[model samples]
Target: MIGSGPGGALTAWSLAKDGHSVTLIEAGPRLRRPDFGQSIGHMLASYFWDGGARTSRGNVVFPTMQVRALGGGTVFNSAICMRPLESALERWRDEHGLTEMTSEMLDPHFDAVETFLNIKAADDDILGRRNELFREACSELGWEWEHIKRFEEGCVGSGECITGCRAGAKNSLDKRGVAEVVQAGGRVYTSVHIDQLIVEHGRVRGAVGMTVDPETYERRHPVRIHAGCTIVSAGAIGTPTILRRSGLTRPAVGSALRFHPSCYIIGVFDEEVNPWFGATQGIHATEHLEKGIKLEALWATASTFSRTLPKRPKQFKRYLKRWPNMAVWDGWVSGDASVGDVRVLPGGRPDIRWQMGDADLRRLQETNALLCEMYAAVGAKEVFTGIVGLPDVMDPREAADRLREGRFERTEMPTASNHVFGGSPMGTDEERAVCDGWGQVYGIDDLYICDTGLYPSSPGVNPQLTAMALAHRLGQELPERY
Candidate 1:
């Protein structure tokens, strides 16, 4: 296993439990529970890729946060556990030849993951005022909504999930799957960066990289590991770059990149929402899912939230005072029309280029419009749309009207995405997909990819659960096949 995220950790644990010797390697350090609770800046520098400054390159530049810690993104994400939509699975089957990836085939694996991780809906106590307001808005609009299922056991609702769960309530894979793998006698290594694979005679024999200091990030020594079967779970960007560096020059190696581009709207209510004290993301609505949108309540630290405020000192200070009364709501668009690719740069870093299609941009506008309407229904005094050329603060109805008209260009809309997919996508056509439906690399023996990169397109929801489902399925078959 060439990563320790959900896919890598779960697969490693599964194989180890079945009496297979497994070796898991992670590029980032293994963080203990005590290492959390730091400021957002500190956490970003220590845990995020490129110190949380990594962004996609193309017409519009926006931050694309990718975690670089043991347990991967699961360590930092809100632990939203959403199954891939049946419509998305059907599209994959019809368009990408991923017939075996249906919910019927993967639900058992999902159940196992949920059971092991204690996945459940956030209780009312943790839903904070912000989440409750979202629920109220959804109810008023007659839109379907539900409490988000999360991998939390004893959550305290500190609203610090993105910075890492300080309470240790989040059931990140590091504490579950990776820990179980160790109990099963699997070898684990952290702060080890693998750049290339040892491919010989069309089979991956092992991998080679350098060990780095966990804190300083200074290179320490070169290391190599030989394995009978190698699984690359280095995530959407890392997996494809490693393949390309190892001379696997197939065109499909780094193609078909996708994302859930999202943005948030701040609704300033007369009553104190206390946005910073709640489940990081507790409630969500999928009523607009067919239109490629999903809505959820959002929360972040005061300093992190301040960054999105007005730059002028007086105006910023004024808004800062209103923070206690603000509720932030977020919506993401399933970026099916948008596409991108990952390429290994001349310098050793991965170069990601993505272009958001016009249709997806319109979807973003529509999402903002819907959020404005939701705020209006909930009796918010004003809203912050964050759409360029529009007033920073406006009446909810006015914002909705302007946003729904789609008067802005792509560049005018600010967007970011943490949910990225594709690059090493799976399909029956060897020439088009780097891996088969079973995650086995098409032309390579004893090598597989079990990550979001295997998704031929966007899953249209939180993707971590689906990624784990795929890994679980691959784990069950690998021990039998190899």
Candidate 2:
């Protein structure tokens, strides 16, 4: 295993359960459940890359927030355990030549993940005030919303998922998949960052990297590992960076980077909604998921909330005063944008650059407007958006007008994408895709990428199940090692 995120962890578990010798290597340190604390910012500061992380585009740095802990990104996610949207799967087939990613092909794998991860629909009894309001608003507006399935138990509805779950109830790989992998006789190396792949003549032989202490940030010792077959599960960002550095010259190595670009809407309730009270279960408007829009409710801790405020401190302070009553609605665009690239910097570091086109911008505006309507229809006092210098939309028409004007500078536009994918896509065409349908990298013998990087296109939903399903499928394809 080349990385210990969800895909790597699951793949390691699968292989180890198959009675194979497996070593799971993770770039970051193992985040303990006790380390999950009150200060969300402090936790994020330690577990996130580059100080909660950022991406760059021609000197413009866009924050790319991904978890650098043992569980990986799931540690900081909203715990929305959605299966691959059927429409999204179709789009992948038509647009990206992913013919084999059909529902039938993915059913058994999904079942396995659901069983192992303990996925269950959030019971209505535990829905927080905001989630209830959201449901009420959806009912009032006739907007379709689904009760999201989540991998959580004993959720006290404290909604600190974006921070870290203190109750240790979240379904992050650390708690579930990786835990099973370890018990199933898998060796997991924490704080071991694999910098480069040992590739020779189009075959992955081994990897060389160092283990660093998360607190001291000191290199522990130089280490090298030999594997019969190496799998890259360093996520879309880290995986592509390694493949490029290893001399895989496929054009799509760093192309078609699809992201579900998200914008958040804030509403102040008459009574305390306490947005940070539930499991942060993502109840999305599935009706619009394939149409390039999704509306879901979420919240943040104090620091992340501060980032959402207007640059003016006075306005921010004014909003902070009403923090108790504030609830957030997030709009994610399944934007018609392909990924750019994660270029290797001179210092052996990685830098990612992406640009959204007119269609994406339009879709963003449309989705935000829709969310505002949903909130406003249910008697929200006002709706504040992430767009800077734009007036808070009290009326639906004003919101539509703001979206119609398409002169947004990339700097003004937020460019953070939690869902990163397609650095090494699977396809039949070697020139267009990196891996084959079996996830074996083309032109490379016994080298496979069974992570989200193998996604030919963004599924516009949570990619966790999809990645796991792919890994399970790959495990079935592997021959017995004897």
Q: After superposition on all CA atoms, what RMSD does each candidate show versus the true structure?
A: 1.0, 2.2
**What global local distance difference test value does model 1 have?**
0.90
Query: What does the lDDT come to for candidate 2?
Result: 0.75
Q: In terms of TM-score, which candidate is strongest? A: 1
lDDT of 1 by residue, 1-482 (tens): 99988789888877887778999999999999889975888888988889989998987886898899999999999999989889999989999888887888889999988888999999999989999999999999999999999999999999989888989999999988999889889999999999899999999999999998998777889999999899999999999999999999878889998889998888889999999989999999979987789999987566876666766899989999999999889999999889999998996789999999988998999999999999999999999877789987899999999888757888899899999899989999888899889889988898999999999987878999998888877788897897
Off by over 4 Å in 1: none
Best by lDDT: 1
Worst 10 residues of 2 by lDDT: 392-401
CA lDDT, candidate 2, residue 175: 86
lDDT of each: 0.90, 0.75
**For residues 125-243, what per-residue lDDT tens digits would candidate 2 score against the true structure?**
66787788777778888878888888787777777887788888888888888888788888888888787889887778988888898776677889898888888888887888888
Cα displacement (Å) at residue 482, model 1: 1.3
Clash counts for the predictions, in order = 0, 3
